[model samples]
Target: MAADPASLTDRRLLSDDLLATVRGRAAIHDRENSFFADDLADLAGSGYLGAMVPSPLGGAGLTLREAVHEQSRLAGAAPATALAVNMHHVWVGAARYLHERGDDTLDWLLTEAAAGEVFGFGYSEAGNDLVLLGSRTEARPDGAGGFTFHGRKIFTSNSPGWTRLGVMGLDSTTDPDDPRIVHAFITRDAGGFEILDDWDTLGMRASQSCTTVLDGAHAPAERVMRRIAPGPSLDPYVLGIFTSFEVLLASVYTGIADRALALAVETVGRRTSMKSGTTYSQDPDIRRRIASAALAMDGVWLQIDQVAGEIDSEPDGRADRGAGWFRATAGLKVRATETARYVVDEAIRCSGGSTYFNRSELGRLYRDVLAGIFHPSDDESAHALVAQSLLGPVEA
Candidate 1:
């Protein structure tokens, strides 16, 4: 008889041996400004890639709450690697999130993910603040139960190894006034797309998130995940995508903050203050900053963990997924990312000038943490979402 799936833990899926290799290679990948190919291979081989696919479907059988914990741990070891792989998890998690709530539109995702078909997120576009609600890309129907996409996608992470890409485009062929946003997972062999090798950045260099140009990329009718309305509507697929993306995105930053705090603690213990005649750990001011960061982090973890648990427990999408749900999800992303930036700043301030060097881990973290501000549910949008939730939409 097969072993019980419930008995499987994230630690088993993410073996200690593989994590050590991933941690060791983080600096190398960053220094080279390259994608984590080895890391991806190891993760895929170790079953970490299919962690959310469900046990019966040949996965490690982890829940979003459990995956959140595992993602935090992975991010702690290598932030860019964790983030790059997080895209894959986002789609799988969304599929699982939707499936649990009686929406089986993307159930094929579980089977594909289990069989080692890497997934990448290809929705981000330059200056497109309407993120996910509308698309700058065009999705013209092919008349044969398919559509061809034409547009450019920026920050296409996991570009080096992804076999399947989840992208979106606007389809005006149906009632131009009320267009639809086509969501689909297109395979690499689908052709009509190009991956531009340009991903050098200030930080998180290891992610190697290149630009993708889709001249006529196509997705078959079977693979078209969703076709949501143009404006904001509480579609089940939309909710799942937003919730999964934000929660998992927050987990990466949370891990960055966690690692930065640990490094700061170690630094304080090692550094001897010339004026105080004692280790910085004993200094009142240094201790205070660390404590403050810790306090803020408590809320960060609570927000992320609670949301993940809520999704797992209340897996019904057809009812009660209101503004409050979106509000909490968006708020968590904003808070967690902002708190991560704060923690990293405190860590650097307490660690001393040595950490300012280019090779120093703190310096890398300081830069990596800044990238959080750029992700969706940005400070502006998140604040607006919160306000809109509290007070109904403003009059025209």
Candidate 2:
């Protein structure tokens, strides 16, 4: 019999079972470079997708901190699966946060998620590094209380499974002098979008975050959520996105580091040094490498937990609006991703030649962790944001 989703109230129990089932299928999906359809089904069926929805709404009602911790645990089992699912979680978690702030605008999002609708983010575009600050996609008004989006979105995760896509586009037609970003939700059944089979990549292969082309894709007026000026505005939507995305993204990478360290420890504890006839775990050099990785990972995990806890405790989400929150989140993203990359490298080093094989977990982790560097808040952008926050904006 399948496990009961409600019984998964204990996060650790859910994670242990999730790891067992999802991890077993991870290698197969990775080898085929296919989406984790089975994993998605398990997560959705187990109510993991609606983890942030209120229990009264027939969902798990998990706090951001708890949800992120679960995400970290899941990633340790299957990084790609966890990463792809993070998109859906971000939407639901954002909606919950907004609702807590007394904003009913995103109530429909929570309702839809509770009803088993999967939400995927489509805010990213090729050559568009400004993130939510700008968009290349055009949101042309349809006069019938709707918008027709025309452009392309890259790295759209959960591409094969998302029923509703949360997307943003620029609407310069309203006022050429002052363009605003129009955020809306587009249904998959809408006629104008296409998902390209172009996700083949060096890492996180199972995510299948394919390129999405939007040619006059329509979002009904009712689905239209927020419209705010480009660049750092104090919009609630922007704050929610930044808070949820950065924290969840950091959690995912942190989980990768956690798993990598565990694998290294296991390998080191078992490998006997031919020269000394003792296990490498006792070797000072090997021990030091593992300890260093552990300490670094612990620091990142603490930051993630702290930030997530603060966000969860905020009644109105106002705590996440300040420049301090931005700096902290940007820093968190950089530190978590970079630390995961470093830890994965150390894992490979300590595991020796065996870990270099394609079948090795550490080998897969090395590639999966690389995807972290390319996500929003890349090292350079993150550093610039942090610097600007501390010293004030640089004079152009």
Candidate 3:
């Protein structure tokens, strides 16, 4: 018989071995701008795709905190692979959150994941700054009880491997004056969706986050999960996505910072200055910079740990929901991304000109860190959310 799918011991062993394998291939994947196909296959086979599902469902039964830590670990080996896999985790985490709250609406999601079905996030739009609050995609009810989506989605990670795509669209057929956004899951076998071959970019190239065009892509009635008014709703599903996505995204970047700092330490300890005949590790300025970066990273890691732990401990998932949780998660995203950018820059500065080469791991990290700025809850949005949380919303 196969090992129990919920075994944390087995999960860790598999992740460790997977990380080792992915780490060696990261540079090559980045250089070629190819997806981490092997990484995805191994993760799926190892039952990692269902890590957030409960043990009874054949998953690892990991809490959000545990899953985020695992993500950070995976990111240290291959940031793109970890980021891509995060989409699947987001869905599973959301399902677990809902299930714990007595809502079994997303139980099917867990079952599908347990059966090795991969899920991808499809909420991003090219110019939609009000993410989740609005959408350019059209969702028309089929009268037969289903819906069809028509529009394009960008930054669809796991595009090449996703068996299901979770998407949202505006449903205005009932009342255009008061349109509502509908969220649903559609399988890859469903016709009318196209994945464009245009994912080349500055960093995280292995993610293969291509653009997707949905021309009347249908989502059956059963898969239509939520329908809510747009613009900062306190719905549980919305909160679940916000909580999981922001935390996991932060974890990925934090892992990048950790790896960059480790590389800096290795370089400084190995390189000797000709004039001083001493390693850079002994240089006071270099030491100070590294110390500062370490301190910043420590702060980010602590915040992630605290927030995730709090959520897990709260049976109702209420301790970290609504405006306060949103503010905290947004702040974490901004801080973690900015900290990673700073750490990677410092690592490059301390390591010398060689780090500027395209093939340099540090260089890839530097570029990859920049992508964080484009993710939701960006610096401006985060600050705005924080300000609104402290003070009232902007006066009419």
Candidate 3: where is the Cα deviation over 4 Å?
A: 1-14, 316-321
lDDT of 2 at 261: 88
TM-score of each: 0.95, 0.95, 0.95
Each model's C-alpha lDDT? 0.87, 0.87, 0.87
Predicted candidate 1 versus true structure: per-residue lDDT over 1-396, tens digit per residue: 111223434245676677788899998888889889999988998888889888887788788878877888788889999999999999999988788877888888888899999999999999999898889999988887788999999998888889999999999996688788999878998788999989989998898889999999989889887788887878878888899999999999998998899999999999998998899999999999999988888888877877887887875543354657788888899999999999999999999998888789888889888989998989999888777777878889
Residue 379 CA error for candidate 2 (Å)?
1.1
lDDT of 2: 0.87
Q: CA shift at 283, candidate 3, in angstroms?
A: 0.4
Poorly placed runs, candidate 1 (over 4 Å): 1-12, 316-321
Instruction: State the lDDT at 362 in candidate 1.
Output: 88
